[model samples]
Target: MADVKLDIRPVGAALGAEIRGVDLNHLRDDEFAAIEQAFADHLVVFFPEQDLTPDGHREFAARFGELEVINGLKKLDDQHPEIVVLDDAVTPAADVWHTDVTYRESPPITAILHMVECPPVGGDTMWINLYQAYETLSPPMKEMLEGCTAVHVNRYGAGNHEHPVVRVHPVTGRKSLYVNRIFASHIRQLSRPESRVLLEFLYRWCEQSRFSVRYRWSPGGVGMWDNRCTLHSVVNDWSGSRIIQRITVLGDKPTGLGEPRWPKFEPNANGASDFYDKNYPF
Candidate 1:
C-alpha cells in the first residue's frame, strides 16, 4: 500500500492527539495504518466530525483486530453485538480510573468510542499514560513493585484474574503500571493492610493531572485508545443526557517482567451468588 499522510496535532503535554483529514467511515489501508501508528504514539487519539452509524463504527473498529463482544452490557444494535452503548440513564459507573476488562484473563487491547449525543456542556473524558506513570515512580517504589502481582476481581460477580502489578505492553514492549482502583482487589505478595495502603497511594499518584489529558466531546467525534497502557475516566458532571458507542478489540493474556503465577483455587467464589459467566466489560 502507498503511504498516507495524516495531519496530527497533540492535544496536551501528556497523552492525547487529534487527527484531522481522515474519515472513519471511509479509510484506506494506509490511512488506517497511519491512525494506528498515531494511536501507539499518543495512547489516545481523537477524530472530530466523522459521522458513523453503528455498522460503520463496528467496521472501523474491526480493522484494528477481532471485535470483542461484551456480555451483560446493553447493546445499541441487536444485530451488531459488538456495539456497546453507554448513556445517562444507566448512571455511568466508569467515573473511577480504570482500564477496560482487566478482570478477564485476556483484557481488550484497544477500545474505540464514538460520540452519538452530548450535552451542551461538560461530560469530558480523561486518559492517563500508564507508561509514564511507571517511569516516573521513585527508584525504591519501583523496586518494591518489581515482581508483585495483584488480584483484579470483576465487581459485577463475573470472574477474577491475577495480573502483574507492572505489565509489559505486548505491542510496544514497554512497562506500564497495570492496577486500577475500580477492579484491583489487592496485591498478592503484600499483607492486606500494606496492600491497601500501597494500592491507594498508587491510585492517587497515577491520577495526577501531570500524567493525564482531558478531551471534550462533540457529535460525531471518535476516541480510540490503547487499553494495554492507559487508564481512562469519564466526567459525569453533565445533567442532560449523553451517549457514546464503543467497540473493544480482543487481547492476549497480560504478561509481565517475570514468571507468571495463578491462584491454586477459584478466587471468585462466594461473591454475589450470581452465576459467573466469563464476560468482558467495557
Candidate 2:
C-alpha cells in the first residue's frame, strides 16, 4: 500500500484539489497516507464517486483523529453519534463563512463531508485558505494583531470562548487568520466600535475571491478539509433538497506563539440575532 500512486489534481491556485484513483471505503495504508498528505498540502481535497455508508464515513474520518459528536440543532444518527445528518429540512443553509465549532475551547481540526444527495442546480460549497489570508496581510496589520483575541459565541448563546486572532496550525506550524464573521463577537483589547471595524475588515480580507475555491457537490462526492486553517460556507441557492453526512475530528486547544488573551464573558452578548437564518431554519 505504501507504493500506491494517487492522482491528485489541483482545483484552484489558492486551495482545493481533486483526488482520483482511490476508493475511500477500501483504503490502503499508503493510499490513506497519500490522501492525508494531499489534504495537508491543499487545504481541501475532494473525492469523487465514493459510495460509503454511515459507518464507513465515520471510519474514514477516524483515521485522522478521534471523532466528535455532532452538536447544536443537527440530529445525529441513532446508531452512529459521530455522523451528523445535513438535510435541507433539518439544517438551514449555512451561507455564512466560518470554521466549525469555533465557539468551543477545542474546535474540530478536520471535517469530512460525504454528499449523499444533490440538488438539481446550485448547492456548491466554498472554502478559503486562512494561511493565505494571514500571509497576504500587510506587515503592520499583522503586528497589530500580535496579542489580540476575539470572543466567539455559539448562535444558541450556550457558550463563549476566545481564540487568538491569528492561529498557528499545530501540524503545519504556520499562521492563519482565525477570526470569522459567524461566531466572532468582538476583539477583547479594542473598544466596541474599534472591534467591529477591525473584525469587519479582517472578515472581508479573509474572504477575498483570490484566496478561495468553490466546490460543486455531486452524489458520491466527498470533501475533506482542515478546519483549523480554513473557512467554509455552503451556497444555499438550490431549491430542491441537498443532503450531506459529516464527521468531525476533535482538535486540541488552539495555541499560538504569542500569549493568549481571554475575552470577557458577557452572557447576554451571544449574538443570536446575527445567525444566518433568524427564524431558526435548522
Candidate 3:
C-alpha cells in the first residue's frame, strides 16, 4: 500500500478531532497507525464522507480490539452479529450522557458509529472529555473520588457492576470520572443521601459545555470515541428518520487508584434508590 498523509483538525478545546484524507474502506497500515495515535490524543475522531459497507465498518473497528455484541441490545443482523443498528423509527433515542455498557464487568473500550442516514437538520451527537472532567476537580474532590467506587446497572435488567468513581486509563495512565447518568447508580462509600448529592454534583460538573464537542451528523460520516475516557449523548432534536450502526471494542475490568477497600453498601433495588424514584420519577 502507498503512504497517505492525513489532515487532522481539532473540533473542540476539550476533546474531538476530524481526520481528512483517508478512506475507512482502504486505509493503509501507516495511515491506520496515525489514526490510532490521533484516537489516543483526541479521545474522539470523526471521518466524514466515507461510504462504507457493513462488513467494512466491522473490519475497521475490529483492528482496535475484539468487537463484542452489546449486552441487552439486539444486533443489526446475524451476518454481522457485532453491529448494533440504531434506527430512530424503532428504537428510543438516548439523550442522557453516558459511557456505553458500564454496567458490565468489562465495559467497551471504544465505539465506532457510522451514520447511514441523517436528518436534514439536528440529530447531532455530543462527547465529554472525562480526563478533563477529573482534572478540573478540586484536589479534595479528586482525593475523595479516587477512594470511592460507584454502582452501575443496566436499566434493561442486564447486570450490575461496581467501578471506581475515578478510573485510571490502562493505556494513558491518566485518570477519568467513570460515572454517568444512564447506568452509574450510586457511590458505595457514602450514605444514600450523600451519594445522591455527590453523584449529582459530579454529573453536572462532567457535562458542562466547556468540556464537550457537538457533532452534526451527515450521511456516511463515521465517528469513533475511546469509551474509557469519555461520555457521549445524542441530541434528540430531529424529527425524521435517522439511522446509525455501531460496533464496540471490548475492554478489561477497570483498575482504580490505590484499590482501596471499603465496606460495601447494599445497592438500591434495580440500582434505583427510593429517593431517586420519588424525586426523578422517570
Number of the top lDDT candidate: 3
Ranking by TM-score: 3, 1, 2
What range of 10 consecutive residues in model 1 has the weakest lDDT sum? 273-282
Candidate 2: clashing pairs of residues:
none
Report residue 172 deviation for candidate 1 (angstroms).
1.1
TM-score of every candidate relative to the true structure: 0.89, 0.88, 0.90
**Hey, what RMSD does candidate 3 come out at?**
4.6
| Candidate 1 local distance difference test against the native | 0.85
lDDT of every predicted structure (CA atoms) = 0.85, 0.84, 0.88
Q: So what's the TM-score on candidate 2? A: 0.88
Model 1: which residue pairs collide? Answer: none
Q: What lDDT tens digits, residue by residue, belong to model 2 across residues 115-135?
A: 888997999999999999999
